[model samples]
Target chain A: EIVEALIRGAGPSSLEGVRVLLTAGPTREPVDPVRFLGNRSSGRMGYALAESLADLGARVVLVSGPTALSMPRVHERIGVETALEMHAAVMSRVADCDLFVATAAVADYRPERPADGKIKKSAEGLTLRLVRNPDILSEVAALDPAPFTVGFAAETERVADYALGKLRDKRLDMIAANLVGGERGGFERDENALSVFWPEGSRDLPMMSKTRLAAELAALIAERYRERHAAST
Target chain B: EIVEALIRGAGPSSLEGVRVLLTAGPTREPVDPVRFLGNRSSGRMGYALAESLADLGARVVLVSGPTALSMPRVHERIGVETALEMHAAVMSRVADCDLFVATAAVADYRPERPADGKIKKSAEGLTLRLVRNPDILSEVAALDPAPFTVGFAAETERVADYALGKLRDKRLDMIAANLVGGERGGFERDENALSVFWPEGSRDLPMMSKTRLAAELAALIAERYRERHAAST
Candidate 1:
């Protein structure tokens, strides 16, 4: 109990008694029985964020994709493989959450017709038709009494501009943007820096370990969430 | 030194002083900076095989794809991400080796033109044009003084037929076939069963832990390798 209290005091515990829905990792889109379309996300950042939110006394329900990471000590965890499965998992439970954070790098498109068997290398060339997947974040934000929605943007270029556009277009309460495909911290790395944006202002969190960064981001999120509630009441 | 002798005595050390070129894990074909076409190989079997071969006193050069597995104790490990890279690494080293084992589930096709930047999710649908990758196993066996080549066939159905066809078609000395996409013993599983075939005969290795299976398979490989050399002499 003392240890828990100390941890709570270290960061803003304004999220006490709040329920959070968090999604992490990259979703795989099947091409065949063995092959799929995947990404480089290691799920370290989002898993650390889940722990940080739980430390601030929030009840965290984590929806995860296929990752090598062990489950975090959150209230619950729902494992899904594809974007469709993740969307279903989140939509089924988002009604009870006080906040929603989408950190999953869900596939934008999936093979339109996945082969039932393994494809043989008989052809000289092949063409795969892909169809767009549903936007999970936009759907959650469109809820009648939506929770304080937060989105994450991983861009190779124009990080801030893309993040701001997402924040405005998705009607999210906040957005965290980061540059990927660089030598520095990003996917598959333990450390990262994020540009956080809200309706009124924005802040830059410097490069640091994902664990430390998560705690700081959690504190900022708590402050903004409290202020939004205060304004509404 | 004592431990090494004990390990060698436990299994056939017939491979002592032999040079081996082996490939393991699934190669990733990049769709873009962030997304890739990947398979379900976990690299456990191949890594275990590398250790088992090393235990028998062979100098193992492992050309591997991206895997979460730690580097196995071997003479050398060449890490690669794509099928083309793996092919280059193997082809450059195969001439110096006496035995070649192709265990990697290399992609049959890669995107014809991979995008320079992360592709935005603007279109409702997209078509990806893929071109066939170089057949690494076939090329290795086609060498004038080709080493004793062993291939792996991962099939969802007709396991034995495919294994034999590949063995004959690729002119390989041996082929190990296993069923994937099943409920038991295949890709991503620590335990597996292999149907090993040679020109004269075939053997069925029952389901067991990959480590033990590797040791058994290595012994069989050593026996066949010696037989082929003696016949040639």
Candidate 2:
């Protein structure tokens, strides 16, 4: 068991020396002094992916948002709270990466103007004006010499359709889709499953601990990345 | 130092036999299958209040939203994630309590109808139709045999005006207001201060660690509760 654990911890060699960038957790968009917009992302999947990549000897840059999980041992870790901060971090590091995985549950919108202080509650109710946040995956894909981009659609309905749609629309080389909140509820859980979709093919990753699933997914990513690199060359 | 720690942890008997209800952390409003509207509240203030109350021999029912903190050893601990859930929990327990502290940073609005599936990113941006969540503080005040309700206002501007306004509008016995995001900031930090207001007068609680502030506030609440009880008798 000890040897098995050690071998599993070390993982594969396909990604040796490769520079990989990944994102995790939920970005917090400040709404006021004490509060900010966020989600229930635990950052488990992305953390697991980072761990697996690092185990495989990849130079990993894990750009993470606010989560309770401790930092993973990787080449670099950039912690951010807001979606805009995450964008800046990813952009600054993209040029040096060989692959990019957009896994953080990034907020699609943020309060257009977060009150400098806490807004007092009113009987009349409140209306918050919000602006769209940058589509991180799309922006990365639009880069002149972009890294192999993998995006995801964690959905509850029509997972395949949405994943494929995002894959095509964002021009992502691959996408992972999953059903959120059920027997395997996505929020704040330790386990997850995924359906990875690529241009001409797809595969089902069965339900398991997030760590195991991420390790397997990371291996798949390494193989696919190499195939793409060879084909392009 | 050890003796001081022990004394602080056990606290005084000022609130002996009291039953107290507190709400802490931030409520989540689901926007889609994989995402929800939320805020950054560490629940430090509320947790501190719970600890102090528990320390003083009061039975505490901590109805909390999402936070990373571990559960305090009190009479009971009720964990919740959304505004509605927190409301339900508080409403169910209010009849048994002599004091109620609405300290949770409940989200004022929630999606009118959250999508069952993940929302696909749109080019023109997406607008979420939101409706106000039920005012838990106001509802508790309206109870036939209401507890001595204490409301909190963590604000950026017009602190006193807003806190007083909420106290009247919600028919609260007392209100505590604080300036959020300054050197102390109000969320996810260890320290805080408040300007507590009653209908007849007000007092300032100086800056201190959340735990210390809570203990001091708890003492004040015990005194105020006794005064009210004596006058009613």
- Lowest summed lDDT window (length 10), candidate 2 chain B: B5-14
**A188 Cα displacement, candidate 1 (Å):** 0.9
What fraction of the true interface contacts does model 1 reproduce? 0.88
In model 2, the Cα lDDT at residue B57 comes to 76
Candidate 1, Cα interface RMSD: 0.6
Report the lDDT tens digits of candidate 1 across residue range A21-128.
999999999999999999988888999999998988899999999999998989999999999999999999999999999999999999999999999889999999
lDDT of 2 by residue, A1-233 (tens): 99986766544337777899999999988777655667768898899889998888789999999888887988888999999999999999999998999999999888788877666555444566678998899999989888999997777677898889889988998898888867774667878889999998999999888889999898888778878877889
Where does candidate 2 clash, by residue pair?
A117-B156, A118-B156
- If you assessed candidate 2 against the hidden native complex, which CAPRI class would it receive? acceptable
**Best candidate, TM-score:** 1
True contacts kept of each: 0.88, 0.49
Residue B130's lDDT within candidate 2 is 71
> Candidate 1 falls in which docking quality class?
high
